[model samples]
Target: MTWRWLLLLISLTACQGPDQGDPYRPYLRVADKDDVPTLDPARGYDTASWQFEDLIFETLVDYNDEGQIIGELAQQWKAEANGTRFVFRLRDDAMFSHGRQVTAEDVRFAITRVLAPETGSPGRDFFLSVRGARTCDKPGCEVAGLVTLDNKTLVVEVEQPDPLFLHKMALPFASAVPPEIIVREGENFDFRPVGTGPFLLAERVAGQRLVLKPNPYYRGAVQPRLPGIVRFVGVPEDLAWMRYRAGLLDLAIIPPAEIPIVLRDPKLSRLLRTADTLRTQYVGLNCARPPFTDVRVRQAMNYAIDRRKLIAILHHRASPPQGIVPPTMPGYPQRPEPYPFDPPRALKLLQAAGLGGGFQATLWLRNDETAIRVAQSLQQDWERVGVRVRLKPVAWGPFLDAVRHNPNIDMFLLGWEADFPDPSNFLEVLFHSRQIGANNHTYYSNPVVDALLEQAASTTEPAQRTELYLLAEQRILDDAPWVLLYHPRTMLLSSDRLRGLRLHAWRPPRLAQLWFAEEKTEE
Candidate 1:
């Protein structure tokens, strides 16, 4: 058996003890993102970030508590002619939160609008790498391949046949949105979501909280066992701990800063820490631009970092990241060795790049305290090598805008997490020259790297795909566009009563399948 399955089997054995054992509990108050701009799937970034969103609207496919994609809205699915084309057979009983039946047409409309630029959707970045996506971007555009043949059958054609297509369908952007709400309403759809997922939005207060209640109109009784409500409290990770301690919250995702204190309490025995393989924190080099244009300059910077110290800052719980994909992920070429903290080597390389004398470079960072800390560390580290660094700090939202949409820095700090477990999800989207949008601040690309990713995406065979990914991963490690730092670990602190909680591929805190003890409920 593969390592993924092996880990899953061992991890899940604990939750499967006895069916009649514990009753699943309902409400969970948790830390949340800054905002979910709209409920319209096409236009929103964090719209579906909260667990409440997951219940209110679901993708055609969804991850179980373990982070593996299980059929959610698409009860049964099949791809035709050797996985080149896909035909999802929808559950006949599936219906939107509104009384309308969910037809194949709704899925097609939702996906097509994502490729439509004028919708003002950030999800556009997610699909640009999709096959046949170019046609949608043309002046008089049309997304050629998607079709709804009947009420239940949805067929999609791709320019290049990709085996990962079905898995990609399981991502948030591919989640089914109501054709009537997302399309007809546009901006107005944020207040009202028309979906076929597990829950419905009850009420939302800006800058404070967002609440979701179980959708009564949902069909089929096979659903999340805990069915009351999921609320996301928009507060810093520090405050989230206090809420959890006060019994006002059941779970809180431990951010880097909070790991130290969260681990201190003997009360956090239920704390679960897992490799969040999705995001990789690193310093990005603008290969074609500015002071970072020289490869030696990039390498010099690499020699100056201390991954051990970075992990120490994160409280030593997270796996010091080896590469973009962890060793747990398939096709790891090799564990990424830690860069030597050699200021002399860094200085020599800088000299080789004709930058021996100190040159001023901007260290762009978001306004978060953590980002500021990381920036401060690098600022001091490189200063020893005669690289004077000016810190460019901006608030999180505008910070992303400056990094992605417009190029404004010599070196930029960033993080990347996989939407799916696939290597193509890591290599193709960020590194593929084709996908360098406002989101891809790094313009680095190579034809060989692109070819390997294309080969991997073209075939469905896991072995062949793994081989291609391994080769591709090695290429990037050598290229070194970004220094691979430690993999962030997510620590979940909840009561012992919180059973069957799973932090899946995206680190989305799923409240489904959890049970409250009968003993605890009475107390």
Candidate 2:
């Protein structure tokens, strides 16, 4: 059968249930293209895993609807010693789903586990600023910065004052896990995670489905309204959309190609939700290699592409970025397009850089439908400016590995979603000379930019910090380490029966707040 017919058949079958049950059942059904690889907070780094982790685990702090940091497991926290030392008081009522009271020691264990060399967690680098974190590479070595001051309080000390430390604590990597469970389950702890969150994993089928039930032990102010959450994993976007139309899924991510079609349909448009996310999609130009090594060549490449046209291709779901930082981020300066499309100017700059004769380079990208389309658009645009482009598409997991490790990478298409709503998260993490093999995939380095980033990160005053970040951003833009593309808007179609569902800029969806609205019957 053809693809359309197959979807139609599935929809027809889905509608033929024997009993017309309540449409507002207290169970959410959602679909995603990826599966959560592991539930262990220390190991899982990708969004797919983090989404599930947000439901199953609780961090010391969390972002409210307004994106402000608020207490979660910790009732309150205070920063002292010029922001280098932090003291947190655990919520007296906080208890794990398995009925154990959450203690400060649990918090210390979670942080130190991520720092342990044996754990090999991706979050290790995120805590390198913690005192003794740099040298605590051995298995038994404790992080001297992390101290448990009684069962109710925890004290943390960093090597330097970091204004964003509380924000980092809100991340899933810092989620508190029961140490006894880890000791008992060992390697199996990843599959059987227990934490202090609103939901507890009840069922799991590899590459298929996961079921979560509300935790009775959860003592947070916001109780889960939904009795359970059912996530269908490893489902493609197209199939998920079909399932959504079939009434099998309460939420589905609208595929890039289907976005325009859904927007045009009056009925479907009512269900569409778009949120401007704190994300930047860009092409990393390898500044350490030839061609892009020259600032003029990098600037010319940035000017070659028509960002407006690219946004159009994305069905106006994105806004052209002015610089590396997304406009949604604080400290993002209001400015005109730095490199507006100018074919003549692009060629002139290339000529001035002594590269008037076209040079060939490979552009790596994830083998996704939307990424492929964007890469092709870039390929055509650069070809007009004497830059011959070869597109190399790899799967998502391997693509990240290649970009981070492969020295031969000339250019790559990637998107960075903010871990926190801080300018330093974008500026320092992506451009700093210190992050060269880490998040700085471009290998772009400038001593002045590095100093500015350091000054911005340490500055506690908001205005002064923003000014430093702006100076660093301006310098980086002139260097043109990346072809700043656009900030994408997250588009998802929600069932009319669902209520209180909203997209967050940086964090996962607030599942606890969501519920199914009561079905209305004709009077």
Error of 1 at 174 (Å): 1.4
lDDT of 2 by residue, 68-179 (tens): 8899999989999988999999999999999999999998888888888688776777888899887776433577898888999999999988878988899898999988
RMSD of each: 8.3, 3.2
In order, candidate lDDTs are 0.67, 0.85
Q: Write the per-residue lDDT of candidate 1 for residues 1-523, one digit (tens) a residue.
A: 3575455444444544323322322464555445554555555443235344556666677766566667777887776665556777788888888888888877776777777777655566555544566567422245557767798888776666665666667766666777656556656677777788777777777766666666677775457555465455455455555445545566766657666665676667545546454666788877778677777888788887776777777677556666767655544455646465678888899998888896888878765556777788888788889889899876555566677666656777777666666666668777877667644467887899988887787776788788888788778777778866667665667765667676665646666556565543233
Q: Best-fitting candidate, measured by lDDT?
A: 2
TM-score, per-candidate, Cα-based: 0.84, 0.89
